[model samples]
Target: MSRPAVLAARLRTAAWLGWQIEANWADPFTFIVYSAVRPLATALILAVMYRAVAGIASSGQAFLGFYVANAFHEYVIRVLVGMGWVIVEEREEFETLKFVYTSPIGMFTYLWGRSSVKFVQASLSLLLILTTGWLILGLRWDWGAVRWLPLLLSFVLGLIAIVYFGFFVAGWALVLPRAAISVNEGVAAALTLLCGVIFPIDLLPRAVQVVAMLLPFTWWYEALRRFLIGHGASARLSSFSDGALLAALAVSTALFSCVSVWGYGVLERRARQNGKLDQARLF
Candidate 1:
């Protein structure tokens, strides 16, 4: 398939998988209830923090905006990672590792569907969260519509990179269980801290700020901040620093995802051949 066609196929497959998952547990109220708790907690925390930093002007909105932005970005990443968790959990729980190894559909396709489903569900939750922020917290969607498009595209692309990173970690989960969750949570927290989710990274130690620049997340938030703040002193990062790094991260993630998928295929096949498939079974 051509590149566009391939991406389309993958997206289509993912959407279909998403529909399947939705159908399995089709309760809107349940979804809403489950999704609301975290954002509510976040709002309370925001109130406390803003109180502590009294008299700040746009920074309040900036902090709130960054929190919402991070919440939005994290929804996608969590979905990507959660899908892998499902598969690994199933393998350990059900003793069906052998079945997974022998399944005709490629493992990547299965994982793609799982991740895609989570992404869709989380997207819905994010829509609700953003809407709440706009209505209650007074977040103004004042940016020119056309100007925001690039940032939106960049955000989605950043998510693509995040999903690939999840797949990469999922590969690790197969061989190293204890280390996987620790690594996953550690990276997630570190990225959130580094990306200026709660506060601007510049206020931190200079060394930490430099490290944050290397992450895809910095690009993601910077794109959103630019859209919200417009062209100004707030937009400190250059096109080369933010835009270039995001593009590089996307490319790196795609390459790693492909490699991880290939590795998983090999491991599954070998496990099947060696009578160790049961050891890796989906629960």
Candidate 2:
């Protein structure tokens, strides 16, 4: 097979391998049920909190929509982080990194394919959350009002950005075998706190807000809010036009992708030089 064909084949095989590894413990029906319950429970908590705090004077449901959307889209962060953390899991626990390297597949193809399963699971949770919100919790979105073009554009850009991040994570894990767990949690927490997940970026300290602006997640989330709710959660960025949001997402994700790919190459070289490819250091 040609190189592109080889990469495509490897990605498919890796994705299937990842799916069976993650879901084999539960039958398909049970796995779907279990995944559905966790996000719904979180959505319920956000709903109750909104009720106690705001009580229906929702300024046309902005915060209600914001928090609830945040609750349900938990998959975004989990998939992003899980993509990074998989390096540790497969390399250390399964003792399979060297085999994959020897199998002559590009690591990038392998990782992206493995992460696809998380994206699938997360998408399912998001669908359930959106349905429950519209039916039971009053999320205030109109299917008619959604800007499908911009929404899909931002969504695809966000996923591409996430794949870049996963590559960086796997690369760093190659070098910092001992700090894999800490690195995974630290990246996840940073996204959770600073990427405008729980609150708008404008509400963050001005200095921190600058860092947040550099992240693709910050732009991606705001773009999503605008596409879904007709306005964004950030007052500071409200003046930015739709064209500007798309431009910012494309530019920021591209820059970040460059940085991630560069960092990954550097780290992977370092790891190979130091003989850390199959090293495990959980302790």
Candidate 3:
């Protein structure tokens, strides 16, 4: 087979493997129910907490809209972290790391395919959550008024950037399995707090806001809110122009991809050389 054909074949197999991983664990109905229910429940808890702290009435349409949009962004972080941790789960729980490492399909390709499945699953969950928020929490949006082109562009770029970020974290699973979960959680929390998932970045300390600007997800979320809700949703972060945001996304994608590839290659080589593919270690 040609190089491209071989790569395509591997990706197809990896995708099938990813699908089976989820499908074999639960029926379609159960999967759908769990996905929808879990995030909605979490959003409710978050809403209550916000209302209590901010003293905002539940009936306030403005707060509801902001909360739902933030919650949706939070869901994106959840998906990214979950997909990244799957590598650790496969190695530790499923005991498939050795087999996977020995397979002809490369680790990068396998993870890419698996994360694609996660992206689709997360997208569905986003829709369900948005619907539930609209019906139950009275979160209102003029969906028809949204700028479709910019919204779609931001979503696509954000998704790609986040997936690469996940892959970068997945590399840690290979080298430091014990720390993977903690590291993943920490990264998720940092991104959530810094990327304005639940509030405007300006609400954070100025130093933190500066740090947030260095992260790709900050620009992605800003662009998303701007496009989806309107300029007012992200007007506070006026430092980032649309062109700058797009450039940041592109640079972030490239950087994370390079890091993930290099890190995975290093870990894989070490594991093979030391015959530690199945060995559990902290370092």
Candidate 4:
């Protein structure tokens, strides 16, 4: 095959491998239950939190839309967690990392291809969560106020940054296989809280807020709230125009992806040198 054809074939095979591993792990009924329960539970948790703060009356309509934004944000967590988690699984659980490394296809390309299944799974979860938010949690649409430009830009760029962030986790996992178990989850939880998953970064401590401001997910979530709900959770984010938000997301995407690539190379080389790639220890 030609170069582009070979690349496409590698990506396709990796994606297919991922799908079999993910979806064929159990029977169809079990798979259905597994997929539906977590996202529904997540929606319920959001509703419970909303009710705890205040009753779901006229005033709660604002947070109902916030639920919409939160539903879409689910994919960010999925991508962030899935990328690195796969590395741990392949290395320790499946004993395939050394074999994968021996393949002609680049590791970065292989990992990205494997994560294509996550994008599909997250899309399904997004649809399910959005439905639950609308039907069970009082989410509603406001088409007139939606700003398509920043919304689209943030979604596209934010996803890029999220995947690269996962790549960042995967790089470290190659060397620290045990810590790999929790690395992506740790990263996801930290970003989810700090990046304003359901709360404003402005409410976090000043130093933490400053840290959040520098992350791409913060810009993405802020833009989602502003454009989708007509405003954000804080004045700092709400005051920025669509162009500003997109520019921040774009710039951060570029920077984060570069770091992800560079860091992955460094760590992968170290793993190769130290014979860490094939080590699988269960504790």
Regions of candidate 3 where Cα sits further than 4 Å from its true position = 25-33, 58-71, 232-235, 263-276, 281-283
Per-residue accuracy of model 3 over 163-252 as CA lDDT, tens digit each: 666766776666666777788888887887888776778788889878877777777776766666655334566667777777776677
All candidates: TM-score: 0.72, 0.90, 0.85, 0.93
* C-alpha root-mean-square deviation, each candidate: 4.9, 2.4, 3.1, 1.9
Clashes of each: 9, 0, 0, 0
1-283: candidate 1 lDDT, tens digit per residue: 7876775676576568556644456786765555565655565466456656654442355555565665565454456567556455546755554464466445566566667767766776677666666676665556454366666776676776666666655655555544556555666677767767666777768898777766666666666665555431123454445456456556645665576567666655554555543454332
State model 3's lDDT: 0.70
Per-model lDDT: 0.59, 0.79, 0.70, 0.79
- Report the lDDT tens digits of candidate 2 across residue range 144-177: 8989999999989988888898788878888888
| Residue 257 lDDT, candidate 1, scale 0-100 | 58
Worst 10 residues of 1 by lDDT: 230-239
Index of the highest-TM-score prediction: 4
For residues 1-283, write the lDDT of model 4, one tens digit per residue: 7999999999999999988987877687777765677777877787787777556552265675457667776776666678787888888889988889898877878888888888888888888987777676557667797888777777888889878877888888888877887777778778778888777777899999888888888888777777767777766777777788878878978998899889988988988889898999853
